[model samples]
Target: MTDDVPAQSLMLPVLLRPVISDLEKTDVAAAQTLRAALVKVENVHPGFTHDLVLGLVKKADLSINMNEALLRLQGQVADTDSEYRLRRAEEPFQELNRRSSLLKKILSRIPDEITDRRAFLDTIKEIASAIKKLLDVVNEIAGYIPGSTGKQALEQRKRDFVRYSKKFSTTLKEYFREGQPSAVFASALYLIHQTNLMIVTIKNKCE
Candidate 1:
């Protein structure tokens, strides 16, 4: 009904073609690079998995997000982005993204570090509950079958907890000694610490 519709419709396609072409090209290039980068899905920009997993854990209301975030933080270089995104050739965009990643890492830790350990403890509490339930089920349900896979998974989980707990202890010592960071930042930091500790404790028990 507008005067511009016919003209705009014709022009829109002309204008959009270049952009669509460019996007397709970018996707192809990125796909080629990623195909070469990962042997298994596990190697796909580990950070994406990490951010996703942390998000998932949080979504599930588990307390393990902080400890996982901390571990994810340790190796993350600012330059390399998640393998899934298209790599830009423009230096400014690349630099900006790299810097952005650093900020993201810092920001992500805030929730865990500032919040109280209650969330972290709750994660452990949940784990304890789940494990007890699993054991109960296994005890009640297992026939004469001898496969130890359930027990093995439990052991692996326990080992993971022990390793993370040691790291959490060291980090907590530094965290407390640093005098409470700003109030805005406090809750997140507390949360991170608590979550990390909870993850460690639960993982230890599961091991």
Candidate 2:
């Protein structure tokens, strides 16, 4: 029994390693999918897409650095300690991973060309809904962290997302009534911008 307990305890960290690795992989894949979707939008709205794409690229770079930092931290921790923290945070990480996968799937629905207005509008609406779900998960994860600053930052992000979502809704309504593509495009860009910022905030504060 004694030998078995030691062996099982030693195996815990090894088992947990794949969970962190998988989360990191999911995050990277989601970022790539989102970037691709933005590029497709760029083809249609050249004037607005460039800045958002640039911002996303910068944030993605930061996310990579943060992931490296997390790996380094994991290595620094004692095996038992690492296992405990990983186990504690595992559920939030899994939830975040799940939401990110859903976001990627939704982003994939964005058409390559915005030629079909109804279709494009429907896709953005779905994207908006997915983003909201992601934000909710992020906010919940942030709540578990200790610092008030992190919580406050997440709150601000929530407020920003709400504002962007409202703009999207209003512009969507305008698009339906007057059929001005520009307004809808602008709102969509705002949502995308907010999403990138929220992602960066998640890395900065939550992770």
Candidate 3:
């Protein structure tokens, strides 16, 4: 697989068909069982099977450094949020800190390796949910700005935030589909750091 391949375009069925065919040649029963499990997972969580397969392939290739990458992400989140207390009001800062803490907790749950599929899936979902909550807090902060000039500035920042969020999501998805765990974690950290900066910017404008 090449980097040029789009994440959504890399269908799990297409990628697994040939591999399953080969597996069936050696062990038909095993191949059938694997296919059935994948189908069940896909039914419950679309696109997850693709991520799982890509992750396994990358793990086999020794391309992922999960522990180190996660540590770096955790550090980045901490460093970015360290300034929140100084830059923001007490209430907003506390909310932001709470959200950041939740995110860090979720990040800590991801293991050094993808040993358990269900656990990894749960962690990923938690991470996604935490990120959305953080973004919503930032949006709430943005909504409080008054005056025409502040509103205009907030609008521009909101546009930038939305654009960057989309880019982050796309890049992260591509990293996952390509089985680049380090890249996935880095992209996630980047988004969180950018979010912190956005909150600071909005707070400044509000003041």
Writing each residue's lDDT as its tens digit, candidate 1 over 1-207 gives: 122222222121222233344665769776555444432343444333334444666899887424333323422422332321124444433433343343334534444544566654454444344333433433332222235764454445445434544444454455657744333232223332333333233223332
Could you give candidate 2's per-residue lDDT for residues 18-117 as a string of tens digits? Answer: 4444554769776555546644564575534434433665977743322122222322332223212222356775566556545544443433324577
Give candidate 2 regions above 4 Å deviation.
1-89, 104-125
Clashing pairs in model 3, backbone N/Cα/C closer than 3 A? none
Between 1 and 2, whose TM-score is larger? 2
Q: Higher-lDDT candidate among 2 and 3?
A: 3
lDDT of 1: 0.38
lDDT of each: 0.38, 0.52, 0.57
RMSD of each: 20.6, 17.5, 18.3
Q: What is the lDDT of residue 6 in candidate 2?
A: 19
Write down the TM-score of every candidate: 0.27, 0.49, 0.51
* Candidate No. with top TM-score: 3
lDDT over C-alpha atoms for residue 158 of model 1: 44
